[model samples]
Target chain A: MNLVFDPAWLPRLGQGVLLTVQLTLYCMGLGAVLGAVLGLVRVYGGGRWSPLYWVASAYIHFFRGTPLLVQLLGIYLGLPTAGILVGPFLAGLLAMTLNTAAYQAEYFRGAIQSVKSGQMMAARALGMSRAQAIGHVIMPQALRLIIPPWSNELIYMLKYSSIVSMTALRPETMDLFGVARSIAARNFRYFEVYILVALFYLAMVLILTVALRWVERRVRIPGLGTPGRGI
Target chain B: MALLRVENLHKRYGHEEVLKGVTLAQDAGETKVVIGPSGTGKSTLLRCINRLTEPDQGRVWLEDTEITSRRTDINRVRAKIGFVFQDFNLFTHLTSLDNVRLGLMKVRGMPRAAATGRAMAELERVGLAAKANAYPAQLSGGQQQRVSIARALAMDPKLILFDEPTSALDPELIGEVLSVMIQLARDGMTMIVVTHEMGFARSVADEIVFMEGGVIVEQGTPDKMFRSPEVPRTGEFLRKISDLYGESR
Candidate 1:
C-alpha cells in the first residue's frame, strides 16, 4: 500500500484549527456567564419549589438530557419552521453554547455549594449585602473550586467543536474535523488524515490541561476544596 | 439605656425550643460572659443579637435601634455589631490582611490605604501583625482566631459577640485568644462572650450570665456567680466546667 501526504492540506487544516479555537472560545466565554447566572438562580432563587429555581432546573435538565446532535439539528432545521432562520454556523454555535452551559452550570452550582456556609455568614456579618457577599467572598472561593471540573468542560468543548464540521455549514466554518474529512475524501487517505487530526486534538488538549492546572495551583485556597483537606 | 438589650427572645427549630424568652442587657464598656452546658442556647443568643439567627419571638436593641424590627437594615446593623465564631470562620481564601480589610473597604467604603492602615492596626492589637499576609490555613488555629478578631475589630463595631471564640482552639493555643479578648475587655469594648473559660469570665467579665435549658438561670458579677450563685444548678454547672476545662488559664 502507498501512503500520500499533501502539503496543501496543512493550511486548510490550520484554518480548521483556527475555526475550532474560535468556536470553543465563544462557546466557553458565553457559556461561563450564562452558566454562572443559572447556577446562582438554581441555588439561591428562593427554594426548591420556587418558579425561578424550577425554570433553571428545567432548562438544565432539558439541555443535559437531550442528545447534542439532536439539539444541533433541532436548532438548525426546526427554527425555520417557526419563522426564525438561523445559519448552520449560528445554529451549531448556539447549540454548543447552550449545551456546555448546562453542564457548566451544574459544575458551578456544586462548587458554590461546596464552599462552607459560614463564609456567607461571615460576609454578611461584615455588612456585605447578599449580592456583594456572593461576588466577593463566595465567587472567589467557588471559582477556585470549579477549576478542576471547568477544565474538563474546556477540553470537552474543544473536541465537541468538531461536531460542527459534520453539518452542512459554510466552507469558512469548517473546523479541524471537517477539513480532515474533505482532505481524505479527495485524496482517499482516510487513515493518514484521521491519524493526523487525532494528533492535533491530543496536542490541543494537552496544552489546555497544562494551562488550567497552573491556574488551579496559583489560585488554590490551601485547604479549601482540596480533596481530603478539611476546611 | 443599656448599650445592648435582648428582651424575651425565643427561637425554635422544629419541635425543639433553642431559646425560650431570654432577656439580657449590657451597659457600654461592659463584658458579659455567657456560660452554660452544651446545647443550652448560648450560641443562639449571641446569633440572635446580631440577627445572624432570627428569633421566633422578641426583640433586640443595640443602643437605640430595634434590631428585630422589619424596617431596620440588618446589613447596616450587622456592620456595627461584630461576631466571632467558634471556628474562627476567617475567609479562607483571603490573607489575614485581606480578611481584616475586606469590611473596611467593601462595607465601610474606606479607601484602600485607609483600610490597610486600619486593618494593620487591628492585627497589631491582636499580635498577628507579622502574620497578616498568611492565609487562614497557614496560621495555627489560635492565630486564625486572632485574625478573625482583628477582622471584626477593624470595623470598629459598637459591640462584639464571641460565640465560643476559643472553643475550637487547642488548650495551649486558647490562652493567646483569651489574652486578646482580655485586652479588649480591659480596653472597655462592649462584648458578649459565650464560653466555658471560667478563668476568662473571672478575670474580664463584669457580669457572668449562666444559661440552662434555653433561659438565663442566673446572672451577677463574675465573683458573685462563682463564689455564690443564687441558683444551685448554676454553681453545679460552673464547677463541672471548671473541672473539665481546668479554668482555661
Candidate 2:
C-alpha cells in the first residue's frame, strides 16, 4: 500500500469544514427556537387542541426514529416529486432543522418541567398574568436547565450535517465527507483521504466538547455545580 | 361590612373532603390566626382565599365583590389579597427587589422607578433592604421568608394570607420572621396566618380559630382559647404541639 501525503489538501479541508460549521449553526439556531415554542405549548397550552404540541411530537418521533441519511434523501429527492423544488443548501438546512427540532424539544420539555411548581404559583400570587409568569419567572430558570441539553444538541447537529453530503451535489456546498469521497476517487487512495477526514472530525468534536463543557460550567447554578459532584 | 367572607366553603380531592362547609368572616384591619392539625384544611382555606387552589363549592367575598362568582377577572381580587407560602415561594430567578416589584408593576401599573421605591420600603420594613439585590437561592431560609413577606407587602393589599410562614424555618430563625409579622399586625394589616406557632397567635392575633377534620372546632380570643379552652380538641392539640416543641428543644 502506497500512502501519498498532499499538503495542499489542507486548504480544501478547511473550506469544507467551514461550510459544515455554518450549516450546523444555522440549523441549531432555527431548531432551538422552534423546539422551545413547541415545548412551551406542550407544557402550558391547556386544553386538548394544542396543535403545536401534536405537530412537534409527530415531527420529533418521525425524525428521531428515522435515519438522518434517509431523511436527507427524502427531503432533497422526495420533495421534488410533490412539485416543491428546493435547492441543495435549502434542502440540507430544512432536513437538519427538522431533525434537530425533534431532539431539542425533549430537552426543552425536561428543562421546563424541572422548574419547581412553587415558582409559577409565586409568580401568580404576585399578580402576574399566566403569560407574564412563564415569560418572566419560569423561562429564565428553564433556560439555565436547557443549556446542557442544547450543548449536546449542538454537537449532534454538527455530526448529523455529514449526512447532507449524500444530497449536496454542488461542489462549493459539499461538506468535509463529500469532499473526502471525491478526493479518494481521484487519487485512488481511499484510506488516506478517509483517514484525514476522520482526523478533522475528531479534532472539531474535541474542540467543541471542551468549549461547551466550559460554557456549562459557567452557566450552572452555583449550589448545583455539576450533578453528583461533591461540594 | 366584613372585609372578607367565606360561605359554605367545601374542597374535596377525590372522595376526601379537605374543607367541609367551613365558613368565616373578618372585619377590616383584623388579624386572624388559623391553628389546626396537619391536614385539617387550614392551609386549604388560605389557598382558597387567593384561588391558588380552587374550591369545589364556595362563595368568597372581598368587600362587595363576589370573588368566587366571577372567575374570569379574579386577578383583580387576587391583587388585593397577597399570599405567602410556607416554603417562601420567591422566584429563584429574580432578585429580592424584583420579586417585590413585579406585582406592583404588573398588577397595579406602577412605573418601574416608583415600584422599585415602594419595594425597597417594604424590604426595609421586613429588615431585608440590605439583601434586596440577592437571589432567593443566595438568601437563607429566614431571609427568603422575609423577602416573601416583603413581596406580599409591596402590593399594599387589603389582606395578606400566610400559610405556615415559620413552619419551614429553623428554631432560631423563626423569631425574626414572627417579629416581622408582629410588626405588620401592629400596623393594622388585615392578615390571616395559618401557623403552628401558638406563641405568635397568643401575642398578635385578635382571634384564634382551631380547625379539626375540616371544620372550625373552636374560635375565640387567644386569652380565652389558649388559657381556658372550651373545646377538648383544641386543648389536646395544644398539649401535643407544646410537648413536641418541648422535646425538640
Candidate 3:
C-alpha cells in the first residue's frame, strides 16, 4: 500500500482541533465554577436548606461511576424522549459539564479542607462574615491546591470531547479522532491518518502541560514552598 | 465595671473537661496575662471569650451586653475582639496588606482606600510597613506573627486575645513580637494573653492569672503572683519552667 500525504487535509484537521479546544475550554470553565459553588455549599452552608452536600455527592457518584460516552449518549438521545429537545451542541456541552463537575468537586473539596481551621477563625475574629472569610481567605489558598487537579481535568475533558461526534447536530463537528477515522475510511489510508491524529493529540498535551506548569510556578507561595520542597 | 467579664463558664471536649466553671474579669485597657501548664485551659479560656470555641454553659459580658447567651449578633461581638494565634494564621494567599485590610473592608464596611490606608498604618505599627505587599510564606515566623498582630489591630477592636503568640517562634524571633505587644500594652489596648513568656507577663501585665487542671489556680498583680505566690501550683509551675530552661542552657 502506498501512502500519500495531502497538505489540503491539514486545515480541516486544524478546524477539528480548534473545536476540541473550544469544547474543553467551555466545559472546564463552567464545570469548575459550578463545582466550586456546590462544594462550598456542602462544606460551609450549615443549614437545613443546604442540600448541596447530598446533591453534589450523588451527582459526582453518578457521573464518575458511568463512562463519559454513555453520559453523552444519554443526554443527547434520552432527553429528547422526555420532551427536552436540546441541540446536539448543547447536549454535548451539558453532558461534558456535568461529567467534569463531579470530578472537579472532589478536587475542590479536598483543597478547601487542606486550608487550616485557624485561618477561618482568624477571619471571623477580624469580624468577617462566613461568606467573606471563605471568599477572601479560604478560596485563594484553596486555588493553589486545586490547580494540579484542575489541569488534569482539562486534559481529560479535551480528549473526551471526541465522543461528541456521535451526536447529530453538527456532522461536521468532527474531533481529531473522528476526522482521522473518516479520512481513513474514504481514502483507505488508515496508518497515516491514525498516526497524524495521534501526533496532534500528543503535541496538544505537551503544550498544555507546559502552560499548566508555568501557571503552577507563578501562583506558588515563596518560603512555604511546594509540598515536597527541600525534600 | 469590668470591660470584659466571664461568669461561670464551662467547656468540654467529649470526655475531657477543659474549662470548669471558670470566671474572670478585666478592666478596660487592662493587660491580663494568663500562664498555665499545658491542657490547663488557658487557651480554652481565651478562645471561649471570642467564641472561637463556644462554651457549654456560661455568661460572657462585654461591658453591658451579655455576649454568651444574648444571641443578638455574635459577629458584631467578635468585631470588637481580635485574636492572634501562635501559628500566625495570616491568610497565606493574601499579601500582608490584604490580610490586614480584609476585616476592615468586609466587616466594618470601610471603603477599599480607607481600609488599605488603615491596614498600612497597622502594619507600620508592627514594623512591617515595607513588607505590606509580601505574602505570609515569604516572611519569617516572627514577621508573620507581627502581620497577624497587625491584622488584628486593623479591626480597631476593643480588646485583643493572644494565644501563645511567641510559643511557635524561634527564640531569637520572640523578642521582636513581644516588643510589639509591649508597645500595644503601652498604648492601653485591652488584652487577654495566654503565653509562656514570663518576662512579658512581668513587664506588661496589669494582672496575671495562673490556671491548672481546668481552673484558675491564682490571680493577682504580677508583683503579687510572680513574686509572692498565693498558690503552690503557681510557684511549682514557675520553678519547673525556669529549671527546665536553666538546665538546658
Give the candidate number with the greatest lDDT. Answer: 1
lDDT of 1 by residue, B133-238 (tens): 8889889999999999999999989999999999888889999999999999999999999998989999899999999999999999988988988889988988
Clashes of 2: 0
Over 4 Å off, model 1: A222-231
> Which order, best to worst by TM-score?
1, 3, 2
What shift in Å separates residue A160 of candidate 2 from its native position after superposition? 1.2
The reply for model 2, stretches above 4 Å from the true place, is A1-3, A47-53, A222-224, B246-249
- DockQ-best of 1 and 3: 1
Model 1, residue B195: C-alpha shift (Å): 0.4
Please list all clashing residue pairs in model 2, or write none if there are none: none
Instruction: Name the weakest run of 10 consecutive residues (lDDT summed) in model 2 chain B.
Output: B240-249
lDDT value for model 1: 0.91
CAPRI band for model 3: medium
Report the lDDT tens digits of candidate 3 across residue range A155-195: 98888888887773343667677777777778888888888
The candidate that wins on TM-score is 1
Q: Which should have the higher TM-score, number 1 or number 2?
A: 1
lDDT of 2 by residue, A36-119 (tens): 887787787563577766776777788889987788789899999999998877889998998888888788889989999999
TM-score of the A chain in candidate 2: the value is 0.91
lDDT, residue B244, candidate 3:
56
